[model samples]
Target: MEMIYLDNAATTPVLDEVVEAVADCLRNYFGNPSSLHRLGIRSEKLIKEAADSVGAVLHVDADEIIFTSGGTEANNMAILGTALARQRTGRHLITTAIEHPSVLRVFDHLKSQSFEVTYLPVDKSGLISPDRLEKEIRPDTTLVSIMHVNNEIGSIQPIEQLGRIIKSINPNTVFHVDAIQSFGKLGLYPKKWGIDLLSLSGHKIHAPKGIGALYVKKGVRLQPILFGGGQQRGYRSGTENIAGIAGLGAASKFIRRELETKSAYLYDLKNRLVAGLKDALPQAVINGSLESGAPHIVNIGFPGMKGEVLLHALEDEGVFVSTGSACSSRDRTVSHVLKAVGVDDRIAGGSIRVSTSYLTTMDEIDAFISILASVVSRVEKYSRR
Candidate 1:
C-alpha cells in the first residue's frame, strides 16, 4: 500500500530546494562566522544575509533575530532570558495551559526559582480570553507568553486582542508569542501586534530541523543564556549553523512567495479530510473550535477507542498521523490541551490529529480516510468482542 503521511504539525519533510541550499552551504561555506579571516568573513556575510531575509519577512530588524537549535531553545531564551534580565522589575509571569512544553516547562523551572506563574485556562473553544487575562494580571506580573496557534488542535488565539489588553493593563509586562506552528502559515506582524518577542521553528515550514529563530523587539533587554564568542548579538552565544540557517532563509523566501497559494491548498485538504472523517464516522467528534483554527490541522476523537490503538492501527494500514504533539506522544497520557478545552477523558483518549501541509495531496487524503475508516471499524469490532 502507498503510505499517506499526514503528520505535518509534528514535522514536515524538508523541501528539495531547502535541502540543496543546506548542502550548498555545507559544501561551500564551512568557515566560522566569528573568525576575522576571509573564509570567516564569507560565512559571516551569509549569516547576515540570512538574518536580513528572515527579518524582512517578519518586518523586524535583522540584528534582533537570534538563531537557536529550534523552537524549544528559542522559547527557552525568550521566557527565561527575559524573566532573569528583568527580574528586578517583577518575579511574576503569565501563560496559557495549552502552550507547548517548551514554554510551559521553562515557566515550571522558573516557578521552582520562586517566580510566580499563573496559567490561565482556555474556554471550550480552546481560546484564552483577554478578559480573563486582565483579571489575572498582578502588579508583579513581568512577562506574558501566549502561543499564536495551538500545536495539537490548530486553534488560533486572539493574539492581537490579547496584546492590546496586556499593554493597556501592564505595559511593562513583555508579551511573547510562540509562533512556531503559525509563523509560515499565517500573517504575523509582531510589531504591529504588540508582540515583544516571537519564536519560530524552521522544520515546521519545510526547512530542516535544528534551526530556529527568536525575534526580540529592538531595545528589549534580555540576558544572555549561553556564554561563548558573543554570537547572536551576545544574547545566544554560539557559532551559527551556517548550513541550517541558509536552508531556513531559503525556506522563508519560498514560503513568502507561495503562502497564498499554499494556504488555499492546505485549507482545501484539511476541509476534505475533516468532512470525510465526519461522513465516514458520524460518531467522530472534532476536538476544538473549527472556525478559529489554522487550515492545516484537524483533531478528531472517536468514542470507544484508544488514541494509541488508532494511531498504530492506521500506521499498520500505511497511514501516518499523530496522537498529538510529537514531543508528548510517547507518554500515552490524555492530552492536557483536550482537557483544557473540556473534552472528557474517554473522548480525549481516542483523539487523533491529522495535519496536512503544502506538499499534501488529495490522493493522500482519500487513502488516509479509507485506512482510517477500516481501522476504526476494526477497533470497534474488537471492543465489542
Candidate 2:
C-alpha cells in the first residue's frame, strides 16, 4: 500500500524546486561568504537575494531577517536575546500555557535567572483573551512571546489583537511571535500588528530542515545568542548555510505563489475529515476549536484507546499521524496542549493529531478515515475485553 503521510505539522517534505536550488548552490557557490575574492562576493550576493525573497513574503526589509537553524533557534534567539538585552529595563515576561517547548523552556531558563514570568491560561478552545493579557502587562514587563498557531491543536491565537494590547499597555515591551505554523498558511502583517520579532521555520513549509529566519524590526534591540565572525548582522554568528539558504528562499517564493489556492484546498480537506470522523465515530471528541483553527490540522480523541496505539495501527496500514508535537512525542507524557485546553487525562492521553499539507489529496483523506474507523473499533473492542 502507498503511504498516506498526514503529519505535516511536524515537518514537510522538501519540494523539487527547492532541491534544485540547493543543489545549484552546493555545486557552484563553494566560496565562504566572508572572503574578499570574487567567489565570496558571488556567494554573499546569493544569500542577500535569498533574504530579499523571504522578506518579501512577510512584507519586511531584508535587513530584518536573521537566518538560524530552524524554529527552535529562532525562538531561542528572540526570547533569550531580548530578555538579556532588556533586563536592565525590566525583568518580567508574559506567555501562554500552551507554547511550544522552545518558547516555554526559554522562559523557564529566564526564571532561574530571576525574571518573573506570567503564564496566561487558555480557554477550552486553546485561546487566550486579549483582556486577560491587558491585565497581565506591567511597566516592568520586557517581553510577551506567543505563537501564531498552536503546533499540536492548530488553534489560531489572536496575535494582532494581543499585539495591540501589549503595545497599549507597555509601548516599550517587545512582542515576539512564533509564526512557524502560520507563516505560509495565512497572511502575516508583522509591522501593522506591532510585532517586534517573529520566528519561522523552513522545514515547516517544504524548505530544508536546518534553516529558518527571525524577523527583527529595524531598531529592536537583541543581544547576540552566538559569538564569532558577526554573521546575520551580528545577531547569529558563524558561516551561513549557503545551500540551505537558497532552498529556503526558493521555498518561500513557492509558498507565496501557492498560498491562496493551497489554503482553500486544505480547508476543504479538513472539513471533510472532521465531518467523516463525526459520522463514523460519534464517540470521538475534537480537542480544539475547529471553526477558528488552521485549515490543515484536526485533533481528535477516542475516549478509551491510546493515541499512540491507534497511531501505530494506522501506520501498519500505511497511514501516518501524530500524538502531538513531534518534539515532545518521545517524552511518554500526555500532551500539555490538550491539558491546557481542559481535556481530562483520559481524553488527552487518547488524542491524535492529523495534519495535512497542500500536497495531500481527497482520496488519501477518505482512505485515512475509512482505515481509522476500523482501527478505533478494534482498539476499543480489545480494551473492553
Candidate 3:
C-alpha cells in the first residue's frame, strides 16, 4: 500500500530541489573550505551563499550564524557554551520542564556540576505563564533557554514577551531559543525579539540530515564547544559540511519564498485534521491548545488504548505516525511532556502525535482522519475484549 506520512515533528522528507543542490555540491565542490587554493575558495563561496540564505530568513547578519552538525549540537553550543562562559557573571540558569532532551540533558549535566537550574512548569495546555516567568527570573540568572514550539504537543511559547521579561528583570541575562520545529513554519525575528541565541535543524525543514545552524546575536560570548582548526570563527571548530550547507541554504530559500502562503496551507490542513478527529471520535482528547498551538503538530489521546499499539496499527494501514519525540520514543518510559501537562497514565499512554509539514496535502489529512477513526475503533474494542 502507498504510505501516508504524518510524523513531521520527527523529521521531514527532503525536498527535490534540495536533493539536487546537495548532489551538485558533492559532485563538484569537493575541495576543503579551509584550503587557500581556487577549489577551496569556490567551496567557501558556496558556504557563504548558504549562510546568506539562512541569514535572510532569520533577519540576521551572515557572520552571526554558525553551522553545526544538527539541532542537538546547536542546542549544546548555545546552552552549555553560554552557561560556562557566563558562569562568572552568575551560575543560575533557567529553562522549561518540557524542553527537548538536548536542552534538558545538558541542564542535567549542569546540575551534576553544581550549577543551579530552575525548571519552569507549564499549564494544562503546555504553556508557561509570563507572570510566572517574570517572577522566576532573577538578577543572577545567567541564561534562559526555551523551545519555541513543543514537538509533541505543538504549544507555542510566548517567546517575544518572555525575552522582554527576562531582559527587563536582568539586562545581562542571555536568552536562547530552540527554534528547531518552528524555523521554516513560523515567522521569527530573533534580533528584534532580544533572543541571544537560536537553534535550527536542516532535516526538520526539508534539508538534509546532519546539518543545522546557531544564530549567535552580536556580542554574546560563548565558550568553544568543539576544539579544532578554528573554523566558524572558533565558535564551532571543524571543516564545514559543504554539501549539507548548500542543501540547507537551498531549503531556506525555498521555504522563505512563499512562507506566508505555505504557513496558511499548513494551518488549513491542521484545522481539518483537528475538526475531523473531534467530530469522529468524541472520546479523543487533544493534549495541546488547539487555538494557539503550532499549526504543524497535534497530540491526540484515546483513553485505555496504548499509544504504541495505535502507532503499529496505523503503520499496518500504511499511515505513518509517532507516539512522541522520536529522540525519546524508544525508551518505553512515559512521556515527560505529557507528564508535565498533567495527563493521566491512561490517556497519556494512548496519545499519538500527528505533525504536518509544508509539503503535506489536504487529501492526506482527509485520508488520515478516516483511517485513524477506523483504527481507534478496532483498537479500543480489542482492548475491551
Candidate 4:
C-alpha cells in the first residue's frame, strides 16, 4: 500500500533542496562560529546568511533573530528568559489555555517561581476573545504569551488583536507568539503585529529538525537561559549547528517563495478530505470551525469510535493521521484543545487530526479519506460489539 502521510503539523519531510544545503554545509563549513579564523568566519557568515533569510521573510532586523534547537527552545527562551529578565518589572504573566506544552509548561515553572499566571480561556471555536483578554490584563502584567496557530485543532488565534490589547494595556508588557505551526503557513509580521517576540521551528517548514529561531524585537531584554560562551550575541549561547542553520535558511527562502501557492493547495486538499469524511460518516463531528481554522488541518470525531483505533486502522492501510499533537499522542489523553473548546471527553477521545503539507496530493487525500471512512465504520462496529 502507498503511504499517505497527513501529519505535517507534527513535522514535515525535509525538502531535497534543504537536504542538499545541509549536506553542503556539513561537508565544507565545519568550523565553529565562535572562532575568529577564516574557517570560523565562513561558518559565522553562513549563520548570518541564514538569519537574513528568516529575517527577510518575517520583515525584521536580522540581528534580532536568535537560533535555537527547535520550537521548544525558542519558546522556552522567549517565555522563561523574558520572565526572568522582566521579573523586576512585574511577576504577573498571561497566556491562553491552548498553548503548546512548551509555553504552558514554562508558565507552570514560572508559577512555581512566584510569577502570577493568568490562562485565558478560549471560546468553543478555540478563539481567544480580544475583549476578554483586555479584561485580563493587569497593571502588573509583564508578559503575554499566545500561540499563532493551535497545534492540535489548527485554530488560528487573533494574535494581532491580542498583541494590540496587551500592549495598549501595558506598554511594558512583552508580547510573545509561538508561531511554530503558523510561521511558514501564514504571513506574520512580528513588528507590525506588536509582537515583542515570536518563535519558529524549521522542521515545521520542511527544514532540518534540529534548528529553529526566535525573533526578539530590538531593545527587548531577555536573560539567556542557556549559559555558555555567549554566542548569538549572548542571547543563546552554544556552538551553532552550521548544517542545520543552512537547511533552515534554504527552507525559509523556499517557503517564502512558495507559501501562497502551497497554502491554497493544502486548503483545497483539507476541504476535500473533510467533505469526504462527512459524506461517509455523517455522525462525524468536526472539532473546530471549518471556515476559520487553518487550511491544512481538520479535526473530526467519529462519535462512537475511539480515535486511537481509527488511527491504527488507517495506518494499517498506510494512511497516517493523528489523535492530536504528536507530542501528546503517546500519552493516550484527550486533547486539551478540544476540551478547552467544550468538547466532551468522549468526543475529544474520538477525534483525529488530519493535517496536510505542501507536498500532499489530491490523490493522497482521496485515498486517506477512503481508508478513514472504512476504518471509522469498522471501529464503530467493534464498539457496538
- Tens digit per residue, CA lDDT, model 1, 276-372: 8888888999899788888888999887689889989988888888996777999777788998999988889889998888788898888888778
**Rank order by lDDT, top first?**
3, 2, 1, 4
2 versus 4: better lDDT goes to: 2
For model 4, state the Cα shift of residue 383 in Å: 2.7
lDDT of 2 by residue, 1-385 (tens): 4999999999999999999999999999999998999999999999999999889889999989999999999999999999999999999999999999999999999999999999989999899988899999999999999999999999999888899899988999999999999988888999999999999999999998989999999999999999999987889999999999999999999988877556587889998998888899899999989988998888888776798999999999999999977779998888889889999888888889999988888989899989999999888888888
Stretches of candidate 1 exceeding 4 Å from the true structure: none
Q: Which 10-residue window of candidate 3 scores lowest in summed lDDT?
A: 257-266
lDDT of each: 0.89, 0.92, 0.92, 0.88
Off by over 4 Å in 4: none
> lDDT of model 3 at residue 303?
85
Q: Write the per-residue lDDT of candidate 3 for residues 192-298, one digit (tens) a residue.
A: 88899999999999998999999999899999899999999999999999899999999999889858556688889988998898788888999878987999999
Q: Cα lDDT of model 4 overall?
A: 0.88
Clashes by residue pair, model 3: none
Listed per candidate, the RMSD to the true structure in angstroms reads: 1.2, 1.0, 1.0, 1.2
Tens-digit per-residue lDDT, 1-385, candidate 4: 4699888988899999999999999999989998899999999999999999999889997898999999999999999998999887889999999999889999999999999999999988889889888998888888999998899888898777777888888989999999998888888988878999999999989998889999999999999999989999999888988899999999999988877556577678877887787777788898878877998888888665688888888888888888877878888767778889998887888888888888888888887777877777777778788
